[model samples]
Target chain A: MALLNKDGSRLDGRGVTDLRPLKITAGVLNRAAGSCLIEWGRNKVLAAVYGPHEVFPKHLTNPRRALINARYIMAPFSSQEEHGRSGPNRRSIEISKVARHVFENVVFTERFPKTMIDVHMEVLQSDGGTRVSAITAASVALADAGIPMRDLVCGVSVGRVDGKLVVDLDKYEDNLGESDVPVVISPRTKELLLFQLDGLLSKKEVSEGLDMIFEAANVIREKQVQALADKFKDVDSGDLQ
Target chain B: MILEEIKEDYIKELLKQKKRIDGRALDAYREIKITKDFIQNAEGSAIAEVGGTKVLAGVKFDIMTPFADRPDEGVVMFGSEFSPIAHPDFNAGPPDENSIELARVVDRGIRSAESIDVKSLFLEEGKVLGVFVDLYILDHSGNLIDTAGLAAMSALKNTKIPKVEDGKIIRNEFTGKLKLVREVAVTTFEKIDGVIIADANSEEEVASEGRMSLSTSSDGFVCSAQKSGKAGFSKQELMDLIDLSSEKSKELLRHI
Candidate 1:
């Protein structure tokens, strides 16, 4: 199957550098202290934040600073073909651990000693680039939860499809394509938070993919800020109305 | 829980005039949105939203041995996961009773309605296909049973039977769409202050005295019914609820 058309457009009829349709909605869930719903192509991810509260299992608590407990879960129904078993599987566990590490760098954990901030990212629908989307949404949720952070984390996945470097890979492109590189960076400090490369890529390709991802991340960062603004826009105007 | 008491009183006062806190009528439901093929990795997937409550259902297939008693039949299994993201009260652990009950209720609705032709999934005497329907509660404002049930049915309806060659399942190859016999929809009714309401939010759910869910087919047959909570309903009330559910099922079925 051709991952790209003869003209270098993807199977989804987008240019190699193009991204899937992106929409981010913040504060969608009422129960969570902070919440965001991200629709990136067919991927539907929800991120929620709770606490700055006490950490259970005393041994796991860090007395000197707050601990970041991040979980990334793929709903069994989130996929198109297979029903994933519920709970933290090996893949989710790894993702959770890495996500926690990524957020730890941004969140000022030392401010809330002996407390924990829980970040939960639920993938209701999965296409591709879910991990990156989850991180993007989780950062916004953290900010919405009133957690002070060095900067918001923005992310994007760049992949080599049909031997061409593409900015964002959808399910088909990600699976059928040759290589994938997902990266997350703090838009403010220009610091890397998460970076992973899967499949084959030359040194030049990796450099090009990073450049593409960085550019795409800036666009994503704008959307994230706008989503947060949209969420508070109502409240901001409520006082005047 | 004390906040529930205050909200319960307010809900009861609102019920006196047949009004809901969200401004819905006594039998009114929140706006429902269903998007099929929401996930790309599953054979079929759908997201169902009823008000603030959201549920995603995905259908997957695997090859398995047929039951000794039912050699020519396939299997349909239902599982539910209530993620902590949906509500603060939900924990990350094994499926609790609420999850199991929700899955069973949704499973019963599909199974009793004969929504999928299980016998068609039988590949050979010993080999059969097993269908798994997984529901994930992404948001839990209230009325999860009904929303999850609808999502499950929708995802199942959207399912395609995967191709199998020489007992090996091909991941990317699909044979054809699954044979579906009927369309099912579940409607849940909650009793508060002696009045029945539809699509209750979390606040209303806490205030609710009794809850009843009825799954109806497109042909107007009640496939399954479940009742929960401490309160009970009168015979007339039960019949009225059935009538209301059947009517509402028609509206929901349109979305499917």
Candidate 2:
């Protein structure tokens, strides 16, 4: 059950700062205004964007700005654990709330006042860092939908396993690690959109871990940009490059 | 929060002058009061009050099959209800996002700090004691996270594991105190008009742009944290908040 090998490599042979295989595909669904699929490590997440439409129930409307509804749900068969009932459980509800907040800052809702934008994230498979993975995909989906954004959001994490600091933890490391800090960052704005910590860590570890988080975030952001760039290429955007 | 009653302009203006609506300094918290073990029926109970926010926490136990991944560890579940009477924004229905987040945040603090020796609660091969901490928001003036956390931690601190006979617990009989490995507390800070203030009241909460809650254990380590709202903090601002929470936790731990 040792998380690390004697040479300091992870169980999967990743370096301390290495991320799992990252693959993001934009515009996977035709019906959604925007959509994307991301495969991070062992996590398979699909995100779709809808609306900028009239608010339902008529009571949840915000006059000054459009409402952003972010819903994160894990499929019943997504995890290795016992089959769970589908829909918003307490964990997903919390994640949805935080994810919703992330889009609130990213999107310029004031332009489309008295409307609602729906961002749906479905976890087809999960290992760990699902929330971060979901949010990262949702951000790309929002852009694909042509929603105006202040900046793109990037999600990443850092953790301590076997008394060593590492980036982009896997399921095994997360479940057994001493601590994990998942963060969502606005690369251009220099703002931390989402920050959540699980387990205990000293001040020094926290500060040091954040450094790793931000660095890993930059790498993830590049992949996101590349994904979107490829999507544009598919659309026949005239390239002068 | 009652949006109509929120004094966004007034609170922001006051904070700019380094003064709070309640006349406290930037780092000051509203008066906190914790009353423990007042509910006699439950194994443990406490009511935490911060300014006008009032939350009650009660601890109960049951025997359940442990998760397959960790058969030797007990379980601690946190539930919360934001009663319609607690705040105007609350509704009488299933728990909403705010309530769920509150319970989880407090739960993370306690669970991460190892407040309960999960292994010690292992009863047999497949069964373990499950501790349930139910938090009821009786009133809302703001800072519910801190209040609920106080109540839960205090309730668990005073809990007594009931003695079991033939796999059934006696009504009033008890073993000893539930051993808490460490104490945990959450300190929430709000950024209003670019000013970072601690323990925001209901009005300030409505006016704030962003919020972050840091949970620290008694041993000076941050056990858990959650950053919420639309706005965000810079690297330095977050670092400062982490340090501030660490220092503020010492004060809250004293009350528990």
Scored by TM-score, the top model is: 2
Q: Pick the candidate with the highest lDDT.
A: 2
Candidate 2: tens digits of C-alpha lDDT, residues A16-72: 999999999888998999999999999999999998999976898989999998999
Candidate 1 deviation (Cα RMSD) = 22.2
Estimated TM-score per prediction?
Answer: 0.52, 0.97
Instruction: List pairs with backbone clashes in candidate 1.
Output: A79-B42, A80-B41, A80-B42, A80-B43, A81-B41, A81-B42, A81-B43
Instruction: Report residue A56 deviation for candidate 2 (angstroms).
Output: 1.8
Interface RMSD, candidate 1? 25.6
CA displacement after TM-score superposition, residue A203 of candidate 2 (Å): 1.3
**Best DockQ among the predictions, by candidate number:** 2
Q: Give stretches of model 2 more than 4 Å off.
A: A234-241, B1-6
- Per-residue lDDT of A122-230 in model 1, one digit per residue for the tens? 9999999999999999999998988998888988888888789999898878877776667777777554466544543444565567678778887899899999998
TM-score of chain B of each: 0.97, 0.97
